[model samples]
Target: MMENRNLFLAILLSIGVLGLWEYFYGAPQREKAQQIAEQQRIERGVDQNAAQGAAPGAQVPSNPAGAPTAPAVVANPGVTREQAIAETKRIPIDTPRLKGSIDLTGGRIDDIALKDYRETVEPNSPNIVLLTPPGGPQPFYAEYGWVGAAGTTAPLPGANTVWTQEGSGALTASTPITLSWNNGQGLTFKRTISVDVNYMFTVADRVENAGSAAVTLHPYALVSRHGRPHVSGYYILHEGLLGWLGDDGLQEIKYSTIEEEKSISHRAKEGWLGITDKYWATALVPPRGEEFTGRFSAVTNQVPIYQTDYLLNAREVAPGGSTEVKGELFAGAKEVRVINEYQNNLGIPRFELMIDWGWFYFLTKPMFWLIDFFFHLVGNFGVAILIVTVLVKLVFFPLANKSYESMSKMKKIQPELTAMRDRFKDDKVAQQKAMMDLYKKEKINPAAGCLPILIQIPVFFSLYKVIFITIEMRHAPFFGWIRDLSAPDPTTIFNLFGLIPYDPASLPVIGPFLMLGVWPLIMGVTMFLQMRLNPLPPDPTQAMLFTWMPVFFTFLLASFPAGLVIYWSWNNTLSILQQAAIMKRQGVKVELWDNIRGLFRRKPRTQE
Candidate 1:
């Protein structure tokens, strides 16, 4: 009863603390992000600056910095506040490097990131524009470029040998440039180029022959990146213990470049050109006598690889013959889903891990698959976590039932054990022997309780591994209040003083306060309820062993995704219900009001 009262008080205090923290910490952080974005918009001249009227005969010109210069509207009709707000609300979030394209037969690369290019380089005419021909002469286009994402197109200095076309499906904009080619053999080919957001591009080829001459051409393609030549670097996310997908999908091949020694390549056996870092690239195939085919290579200033050798070579293409080679380029983040999609589209095998352990193969894989499926279904990581938790509970329900039954049997024998201990007060060994004999005579298996406890260790570790490394949890969100599953609960309600430290990036301080304060308290109370219903037999050794369960788990969960915590909290509540149901079935009486009164009334006993 005292325990119950203490638990209730703890819960109330926790709720109060959580509420205060949320008020103080959470709200301001989220507001800060919104504020930053708003400020960026204003800086971008999307707000008030856009509304100012221009002087008569003065036109706003495009700024060289790639920012739009607002054309002032003459004051004709007064605009209302609501109208301005609606206009502002229509602004879309800007996502860079939106899309790209390429024209194979026409030999034109359009929609280049000239704006991004200009930011990276100075406006100098000395920089060379290099383009590689399929088999013939190399053509050099003089650098006549100055353009920005926010700037108007720069006029070319010489005749238009090559240039970009502005359109939705232009070659240089969206990723994985798509192109087509036709040779004199009357064969036409269509190919799609996809680069990972990382800038690793892949080419998928499809060829159709109009004239049947049993034509076969070994495909080889090359595109030039101009600069003083130097050694490059490269790396592939392969399929292994953890990299199952990348390894199996890519064909093993080796290559020797004029710039470096021979090494293994993740690029397909037929050769695929790609660049990991770089803003602009050009392909110039100056007439290779109609049977032409080739590929292009992109270069960047800095390579994004942890290991040695960073280089992606140019791929080869053949006339009257076609093969699809996929290139994946990563720019923003090294996310697995985006990588997997591009790899799969290139007809690469899915990433798979090699774990031949029989039990792991039988159990862990199925469990992972189920978890993955649930992750896909709900989309919200927290909900997926809850589902996985429930599934795990259901799977272990039988073991728990057996353990509970053993505890019940132990409780029944407590009186008998006490009698034997009292009778042999001075002979501990003899008492234990007598107790064992009585147990054997009663046909009770003394080890029943031990099996469940023993099995939990490995199961716990396995589940821990799954939750910690599973890619599905990355960037996944929960419902209202909790946005990012990977991040901590945002509600920080109150401060040490009465003031609230608001974090606008997250929910109002209320979120963290409830999560940190109220949540722990709820957990404690639920734990108390669980203890009452499924009480463990009083054994110091078992108690010490079981203590590690919570301690180790709490430590392990400290770095775990918040989604997992939510699942665990819900799981604890469910466990309490299960135990309470079991206790009710065993005829245990639970008087709510009496329990509460007894808890408050009882005073702690002091040692004499």
Candidate 2:
């Protein structure tokens, strides 16, 4: 009994701490993150809510530890993204998946908006602007230029160097656009920028050496974002600079990490690097089979500037000869299919890692693949989740059955257990020994019940990873009231599902727990039903944990994505049915209804 109590207490404490942490810490962190995100949105829109391309899929590798030093950021105060867009002569980017423009001032693919996704679930909501211009409040833009080598006196095309558009029509997937710049030192640099039907941009730069002497220069590409964007704050999902560098494996550096380290440099023979938000990414893919240096850095002084850049080996441009280098840029949604396509078809090294598959890549990726496959068949992500939950139950059926069978035996021997307790009422240790002997004689494993929890933990975490990390799950809707499976259920019982005028989330102290959503309540009830399949633990503390666990999870999961809560609810319902069936087949009385009714029934006053 002591050992059993210790085990139950440990389990209760572990679960209680996790639940409490989510309520006390996770919820507040998310709220703080959301507030920061909202403030960023307003600041970004403070100047029309302003606005927001690629090179060919380039191959990989890096230079020396020398990364391009970031120039001091002079933020364009009071400048709207609209004004910035209008300020420059831009080459319009009108792809089927994207619609924006390429700023000709620096010849940077600075402006872009995803035509398919929106800021909100509303169909007519503003398009999700992925990149913005330099003058914008939260400036996120990509640049391609050459770094001057030792004894190189010729000027190169840079951020301040304005390039004139060579052709007329807008930059489409089929028709590439060319921008040319003259350095006056007889160096004629031309950049041919092209885009595929999707998010990949092909930037091929050619430098003609029409001068008298040879010039040595290093070709480099970088993605820069001025201000830190709001992160979801969930540790499961990485929201910062990340990429797969050759030999270096995968480098995931958070903004805070970069700030502390100043800059992280890597020399790779083949790889790519980029800055990523939860759903969106902008990665620089250097051409294949090349030696280059990749750097993830942060410059914080007036306005924080975070940059992910790569510098390639210097190319010697002989007199009257030309040198050309082609690089690829991925600037849009990190769709699994497209990212994999680029990874496989283009020979980019482990490019799919850009999606933040986490440490459980082996399981998480396959889980996503299964969920995606089912989604394609069902046409609704929520239905797909239900189907996957059922499939998971089936896969673990034999283990679950054995566990339930063991629980059934324990439940059947409850009368003997009660008699044993009364017989050894004075000696607690002797009572535990008798109970163990009975358990051995009946061939029942009391610890078998923990199997369900063990199975649920991994499945639960993996699903949460899929829902939070993948863009496909974003904005996916279920039936009534659950519009975005990626977001928490909108309707809360605290405000009577929003019938009341004020927000319960705005209240003090208990506000976070009050966010109990409908799906969470359903999940809690299902869990309660499942727990009642076996008799309550004889110990009061153990009994208390069993009784209150459902409520604890219900409150904790209210802040989780709706899809996860839905899965838990469906899984619990299945477990209840499965356990009840196992107990009935074993000729044991299932105490579900009796235990439930006993909770509410009045007890006769005890004679003192």
Taking every candidate in turn, the Cα RMSD to the unseen true structure, in Å, is: 16.4, 5.3
Candidate 1 lDDT tens digits, 1-608: 12223334434444553453334223434544564564354334422443564322111232222211111221112344234223221111112433222323223222122212222123542222222211111111111111222221322111122222222343332433434444444655455544433333444444454554433322222222222222111121111101121323422211113123211223222212222122122211111122211222122211100111112222232434433332222222223444455446544333222111223545555655666678789765566667877777788788766655554555456568768877998998998799888777765566554543355445443444344444444445677555556445444223312146744335653433333422333344554444444332234443333333343334323333465556556766776665545545655443333433333443411111
lDDT of 2 at 189: 94
Local distance difference test, per candidate? 0.37, 0.82
Tens-digit lDDT track of model 2 for 1-608: 43264347547756774875576457758765775876565445433222321111111122343346443333465677888889888889999999999988778888999999999999999999999988765788888988888767678776767789885999998999999999999999999999999999999999999999989888888988876777776666788898888999999898878878877788898999999998999999999999988888787543567889989998998999999999999999999999999999999999988898889888888889989999999899999999999999999999999888886776677677778878999999999899988889888788876787778878887888899899999999999999999988888987899898878888876776788889999999998887666555555666676678888778878888899999989998988888888888999876677777755545411101
354, model 1: CA deviation in Å? 13
- lDDT, residue 589, model 2: 70
Per-candidate TM-score against the hidden true structure: 0.46, 0.91
Candidate 1: where is the Cα deviation over 4 Å? 1-169, 172-201, 204-346, 350-381, 450-472, 492-499, 502-521, 532-559, 583-608
Minimum summed lDDT over a 10-residue window in model 2 is located at 52-61
**3 in model 1: Cα distance from truth in Å?**
20
Top candidate when judged by TM-score against the true structure: 2
